[model samples]
Target chain A: MTILLHQNLERAAQALPEQTAFVCGRDRLTWRQLDEQSTAFAVALQHAGVTPGDHVAICADLSLPAVIAIYGCLKAGAVYVPVDHSSSDQRLCALIEECDATVLVITALSLNTRHTLETHAPSLRLVVSGENQPEQRSRLEVVCFSGFLAASGRDPFVRPATTPRQPAYVIFTSGSTGRPKGIVHTHQSAGQYAELTATAYRLSSADMVAGVCPLHFDMSTFALFASVHAAARTVLIPAPVLRFPASFALQLEQHRVSVLYCVPYLLIQLLERGVLDQRLLDSLRWIVFAGETFPLRSLQDLRSRLCHVAFSNAYGPAETNVCCVRHFVPWQECAEPDRSEIPIGRPWGDGLCRVVDADDVVVEPGEAGELLVSSGTVMSHYLGHSADDQPTFCFCPATGRRFYRTGDVVRQNADGELVFVGRQDRQVKVRGHRVELDAVENAMTRFPGVLEASVSCVPADGSQQLHAVYTSVDRQALDAPLQRWLQSELPRWAVPSVIQRVPTFARTTSGKIDHRRQGQQMAAELTTHNKKES
Target chain B: MIDQSSFSRTEATRQILQFLHEELLNGSGPVTLQADTDLLASGTVDSLGVMRLVAFLEAAFAVTIAHEDVTMENFLNASAIAALICERQEGAL
Candidate 1:
């Protein structure tokens, strides 16, 4: 009796066939329609030679078709890999090759992306989702969405038999080696996460959930799968709409979204832009925040404004599906400004969470150490890489349970709650996207004239920004070319916010790059620049 | 009530092209940017580029472009962005 993820969709369609499932702009779909369309899509994938355990790649903006593609791949028992629509051709090709993807579903809105796929990944089949198909030239066959759907019969297609232990999907994350690492999660892990999330949020079919995250981001699981598990309707907010806080707040009101999962950076932006108001967000009950640490001052402001909404801070890596969660009573937390740190709180379910010192021994209460978490929701392994290559896991002989080293420094408070301190590694969250400072520096060093590059995250206006300090003796005019090179090589988010030219980098007593002092100096310079502008 | 003299398409295009050359692409690059260059289609302007362009427009034109106005249709090129700026300035008038 294995619990499958697609079974959630089947059960919801059986119970509430006419209920609204997903809403993106004016487009809406009922459970019955979603179930049927996904089944038809699965049949179409099968017709296109997508067999069980095949890898299907989806690169599109947040839309109905993208949702359908995700479920269809799952229903067909294939691992779905979602990349951002804005990914460069090189990165996308690398991902396709990395996963050995057989079929790629794209939107006509992205003609450049479609062309790139056709040009680069010739062996892979392309399923165009929108109109305005260009004249085909590649050896691969291209099928328009309407044509592809029409090619398959309307009969309900049964999903292939799969156990919970099988791999469900692979999500790519930033690697320290300047290459993206694919983390594979089993069906049981993802299903348990969705179920646990639904129960934690107390979601019901009556709740309207707001999807504020991109499909490639791990936090989006709550918006998509968790909503399905609870039979709740999810309303996806487009990226452009996210820029306009007023319109986004209006959408929340119009859609009557009761549950929301978002990063603290976005919450701060909405508050700063004056888009968050009591009346506009009156329907919101649960507001979950993750991906990055929320500044205590901003959290206080948000809590004070929206006293009725429950604020929960969740802590986990992409490897672990949200192991710990802390629910905050807005009124209670806002009253005490002395609460400088927000506790990530206790573990969800029976998951084990421990704070260990450098010696791997359990730390004393209130002593900082690396946080280790292990549960049924931990990722299976990194794809194409052996456990020894990048060992984020350890098998403890005493406990007889494998544990993931989260690399996050934390301590248990007096109340037996985990309080996040900082990261022991260079991994930092830039606008909720995981970025490795070393990885950015690695890309920076590849430039023709770069002698040495030191990249670090600096605190700016309550958010983290990557700032680079480089010394290039050969390249006199290095600013613009270096920027262009970085833009072409790395994703936009991974690019540095500000790059400074220096004759030489400061070194510590051990002759290592002094990133700490560099970060401090960069922050000070940015502050002075801000003052001068004012 | 409206002074329409400041909103010139040619002037907007000149400024936008200059900014793109200086900021996004190096001043001297293989890709020749034009007024009608498709920013979204060519992948010249991505999400971060859009944000930087919005900041530039707000500072240069002394106008505010709302988030909804930052779509691909509006920021696809110098011409579209210039048109959006003109429209916003006219609305302000």
Candidate 2:
């Protein structure tokens, strides 16, 4: 009754034997070819000392090689961890060490990355898959992805039957403090998440998903594997697209991609570029976006542009696969609902989300509380941190099942929709005033000329200052009205200490605000100011 | 609102100053900055300040100033940064 994620992928291959499973430019691989490559890569890795339960980290962008390697790692019975090739040299090294990665498969540009990584973690066996290597670098088995399989030319290998409880992948997410946390997930959790997503979005073997999120980011879990599990094809978008949005969408239109998973910020840029053209969206059947929600005007434009396709908002942290979804809510309601707030919506099949108070008591309808999720899709644990209770997986008496505390503040509306307030830690006391930014943003979201807003805290003049980052296309016109609106609605002390404008806010691969990056940016800015003043 | 004519006197420094402000300097200040702003020797920018400023010029102007370009003559003041930006522009063309 229970199936591992790889086994399900194998099943997808069996169902769509000759169908194209993945396509990258002129390079097309049928399901059969994909299965053969996966098996061969699995064997190649085994020969390289990768055993069951080992962590094999693929340090590369989203491409066919990375995708197959993920499959090979799972098929070989090891938990696969992915690092964005674009991750800084420092971060890449930190992740490899943090995950205690065994073997790394990388390309040439990441050669510097691989070198720096090995210098730190010398035990990590490196597999350089690229052009010929120097004589001295023999230990770095330099082989092309195809060459690796070609060398094993139809070599017979058996995939060990992995149980549902076995770990499938280890994904790293930002920590409030030092290094990122590596959250591990088992086959049951990963595959269950894939199934829930496929059912919610109505993805099938006929769908051609435009995979956008980086592999290191958790959003790509559903974008990549969900498509593969459904026997659907994934269009391997190039990595540089993150730096260029217009080009990314052109690739979408060129490929006639049917299913798209994106973040709201990128969607905002796409709208700014007037990318809501009907021609580009004609074949698109669904748009599933995650991270933080964007303005409603965007959803309305997107829906009208692709009037026929479904627009769904996906919600959940990396620690948990997408456990809840609110689909087909109109852009207007979703952007500015009747309650002037939107819920991550009802839990999808087999997923349970409830609002609970401080004492774990379930709140009544329209009451605000902590959101807890109980689902088969919850992560295994933060790898190597088995002793932490905050990360502890437990069963809730209210849900009568194991649930993960989402740490998000929300209130169930009269319509039974859950509207997000913010994170519990996000609440702050500013100058004897308790300011919940979510409340301010929720209020400002109703103000005209207010496209998107995020409130962050800082210490100013011996008191905490609430800073708001706002993004408006017509910044020139928005300046005066926005300042006036904030002055009227917010108390003297509650007003923003600094009102900063970004041409565009940094976004996580999930399209939510890249708060971690913003913090780094804010810190750097503060340091710059302190020096300037001194 | 930058007095473009006022910048003609310290073209090199002004360019570098703007580059630093957009890329290196993070906090808010005069939107229209000037050159000969006593950037480095005057203690306007420090070591990490230099690195941050270099990264900014590279991304904002799409220029690549070499490690050798990180010199007193190129990064000392607005004139220096403008010179650096100019050198990169010439090389790029």
lDDT of each: 0.78, 0.70
* lDDT tens digits by residue: candidate 1, A352-406: 9888988789888898888988788888888886543335787777877888899
Give the poorly placed runs of model 2, Cα more than 4 Å off: A109-111, A137-142, A329-339, A387-391, A397-400, A487-494, A506-511, A516-534, B1-93
Please provide TM-scores, in order, for all candidate models, with all chains considered together: 0.77, 0.80
Docking class of 2: incorrect
Off by over 4 Å in 1: A109-123, A126-129, A135-137, A155-158, A277-279, A332-337, A385-390, A427-534, B1-51, B63-93
lDDT of 2: 0.70
Clashes of each: 0, 6
Report the poorest 10 consecutive residues by lDDT, candidate 1 chain A: A503-512
Question: iRMS of every model, one decimal?
Answer: 6.9, 15.2
